[model samples]
Target: MKYFFAIIYIITTVAINAQETHKRTLKLMGSRFDITVVANNKTEADTYIDIAVTEISRIEKLISSWDENSQTSKINRNAGIKAVHVDKELFDLIERAIQISKLTDGAFDISYASMDRIWKFDGSVTKMPTPENIKASVAKVGYQHIILDKEKQTVFLKIKGMKIGFGAIGKGYAADKAKQLLKQKGVQAGIINASGDMNTWGTQTNGDQWKVGITNPMNKNNVFALLPISERAVVTSGNYEKYIMINGKRYSHIIDPRTGYPSSGIVSVSVFAPSAELADALATSVFVMGKDVGLNFINQLKGIECIIVDEKGKIVHSTNIDIQDKLKNE
Candidate 1:
């Protein structure tokens, strides 16, 4: 009887320790990164986290247009002058981004870097830009104009000032790459949250799926719904944080590359997909596409889902995603 009770105590203690979750927070890629992993020891978790950080930084250097020495910056600097040769990694990433632009009908464009910032969402703007000004703003912003020479492995912007930047999808790409690297290193489960672009694999220590909450755009502190996810990516793009009110109307910071106007009618769009890169771009596209068109587009995709909150504070979800109210359960 003494030996039996001792065995039970050891089993319980081991289980408790195995369920421990270790987390590390840092700033990377101009965003707050919250990395979490379930591990048996602190040393193991720290090692995996460091690997993720290094991978993210490497990707940022490769794709950052702001960095004068980055490959992307070189491509932009030579716009209309010559085709800039680049590595296969950047070439493939740009190809994929262009594909997404076609799918979204230019709603998701990387050439937005060339857009004239004539429309300001700041509180100072009391009037809208004229039609001619709006049209001219996007004259240099078109995905079709971004030429990719597959045979020569070069990227060329047809217009002299035309440029491509990965602001919309860069963080998510970093998250995906970090997750893949950690998994390759034999890390069972972890989450890479770049700002709000979160990608997770494996389960929690308690053997349950990770729960992600969709923040209520109206009440920033409260979550409207909770989503259960495993080996999936969820990205939320909301304009609530950066917007300006003018004459009783609210304008989001996200401007449509097609139109020089700030995206309106939608407060937030959260996307879940197999890859964080896709989810991130889609979230921004949905915000520009508005609720009805965005939901329709998401519903057609096999493994993609979306949740949109409109300006009226109404919560909407794509056909496949059914959100659970955690507050109601509580």
Candidate 2:
């Protein structure tokens, strides 16, 4: 599940003389990417945006499981057959994904790609899967079975038919990488919004901090708060858009890989962190962790905050974030 954000800005007198904000929205990595850059003119902004597009495309080819020639596909094809050597970048990404799996106690697992897709979010489903079928659906899904060789920079899956994919983290990682490359090229301020995974650097053209309006889960067209963020990443995972009802109960599209069942109890989770990659992973993790456990887990981590909206429309936030002050309707 992904959420959308509204970019808020207050025009100032400096806008006429200062660098202007140029944005281009295009399709990249099978998702919509809105790349915005602050530049003196349109040509320079287009140049910077093109560079970011190239970088994002490169990352997609490296990690996309659908592309048969990608290194990730090679690794999946050789599962339980042999250890396939991969580039250091891909190897390191897999290693970090494993670390996150352990930290979340298996709440977040790339190996979840191997699970059978028994739960459909489309409106056609009228009932739920049985206990036995649900249990067997996740038989091949286990991160513990994934083996990494640091010496050879190889990845090996111990079980046949086991695979891994980065649907949750790939876009955010691409956004972070694009932002990094643009920054190195002296693009002072920009935003790479890969759907709802947003990363911002520097400030707006008017020298004001970039702000994003948090969408109200109860009403998709309304916003509850507008929070100013600088040099940070924010990601929101919500079930409001994609979910199914069975026996008058709603089940989110975000399935818990361990149980082979869709997640419940929470409607949305928004996480703020230093990087979009971390924020993306944590947002999904919080949904699976439930409201209470997720809030506790986030409170323990420094430099990280989250806001959760339960099914009852009740809102709760981490220790560091004060939503009351940012409420747009207040």
Candidate 3:
């Protein structure tokens, strides 16, 4: 459940049109959020951005596990005790997360929060964890144990120490919710960038599609491609920013919840889909699945494309996406 930095950079220029693009940067869900909206004037744009901020804050309060008063916390506190009734929105979100867990065959699980922090990326440990300890770390981290009742609107963890958190998908869900609210309020175009969990609708003020620059995992300062996106979401999960070198091999901070060990081989994964929530989850899933299996998994899904950078810095993409044609070499 470690959150990575934003690897997708927004490519923007000064707006020359009457309808200007307004942007505001702030902290939401314990991460950075960049909200941009196209409006007739600064006042209107600010109003729209404020609305997005409010919506994101509301979502954080509902889903944040760190908040003791949050419904998510209540659910965790009641693990193996009783089924805790939750709001319909949270119920649906958890339900969707469970479906994604099944789709990835448990590669993407919200119950990853139950995992013990045995592997440290802070360079405090000079050696890898014991195999037995590593195995035990994930004993309580199984999505299958999360029982949900639709009719009762309740969520229950079958194990006593089991817990669930949304560090991976919460920001994306917030971005999607904010975008939906802004669009319903008559905002024609906007981009909600929750760290790297970005969602866009409509186009730029000049009618061109919004561009996103994909960072080269080998060179964090370098951008390799610029992809034009409209009415879509793109999320990039990279291990370049947070990792440790052990026995001359780099270990990513993104651990595979099933194995209880940090993921290896793949350095970065970018996923583009219809919603930021799905893209964010799949981005992490691809990292856990490694390059070959991850690429194959993404290729099988329609309307979902992925770009992966392996440990050797080799770039591979899904069938529907051709980054070579769009490479900027920047």
Candidate 4:
């Protein structure tokens, strides 16, 4: 009996000290995703991430506005004629996007895709567009145009050619859903990095917290900070990464729906929230809204913080934000 008790104690000790790391990376939705977890075994961690990916893929099939057969596409197709029933998740996402649009004073709009692609940042772009061209671009860009029926769970685009998409927000939504799915699947430690939007939970295998690197907008190969965080999502949006430079000026792909022009003043916006989905959408909103209003908007919200960096590298932070260290070799 004494030997049995001793063996039991040793087994418990081993269990306490033992941790396994699992990582799974895959390409889906035209992006790269890396998920890692520290669990009792490698298989469990991988399984958790796989489950999350499956959930994301299912949502993509249902909600992708680009996919012609998707429910959202069907809604766009049936505009002005009939209301198309949609998945509950897609309905919820659109509703949240509309709310964000209202909260940001139309800075965050899903209908921006309906705008004309007039202000191209390509090398071919020459002189500024005429006032009429700029005015016409925002013609179909309005959140009020999206009509959703609660009882029927249906969506309708009020105007023909007016469309909605999750380009700026889908990856974050995927990350958030994956995180919740991971937790439900008995995962204690893991992270879902859907491109620049990422969420993490619990500790690492070494008993230390997870460290996330914020990529430097100025330095492509450097990180601005090494944040030791858990149970939080970080999203970064920057023009320096995907913008086109012409006439000694840079134009970002992220357009402001209210102005029908690309955002100016702010260069990058990083938001930390409870979930990646929220963080992602809010980051883009803040970027287009500029520093003052954007930071104020984020600070007013609970559990949301932002770091705004301008073209000159001057940083403005929300109420509870931290930038531990600047980028090395920037």
- lDDT by residue (1-330, candidate 2, tens digit) is 334433222222237755888989999988888898899899999999999999999999999999999999999999889999999999999999899999999899999899998887779889989999999999988889999999999999999899999988999999999999999999999889888788999888778888777765786666676677879998877887788999988888888888888888888888899999999889989998899999999999999999888887777889887553454421
* Residue 18 CA displacement from its true place in model 4, Å: 1.9
Writing each residue's lDDT as its tens digit, candidate 3 over 1-330 gives 656678788876646878998899998887888999999999999999999999999999999999999999999999999999999999999999999999999889999999999877777967898999999999999999999999999999999989999998999999999999999999999899998899999888777888988887687787787788889999987888778898998888999999998888988888999999999999989888888899999999999999888888887789898553555422
In terms of lDDT, model 4 sits at 0.74
How are the candidates ranked when ordered by TM-score, highest leading?
3, 2, 1, 4
Q: Which candidate number would show the highest lDDT if scored against the true structure?
A: 3
Model 2 off-target regions past 4 Å? 1-14, 324-330
Work out how many backbone clashes candidate 4 has: 0
For every model shown, what is its TM-score relative to the native structure? 0.92, 0.94, 0.96, 0.88
Backbone clash pairs for candidate 4 read none
The better candidate by TM-score, 2 or 4, is: 2
User: How many clashes does each candidate structure show, in the order listed?
Assistant: 0, 0, 0, 0
List runs of model 1 lying over 4 Å from the truth. 1-15, 326-330
Cα lDDT of model 1 by residue, 73-119, tens digit: 99999998999999999999999999999999989999988988876
lDDT agreement with native, every candidate: 0.82, 0.85, 0.90, 0.74
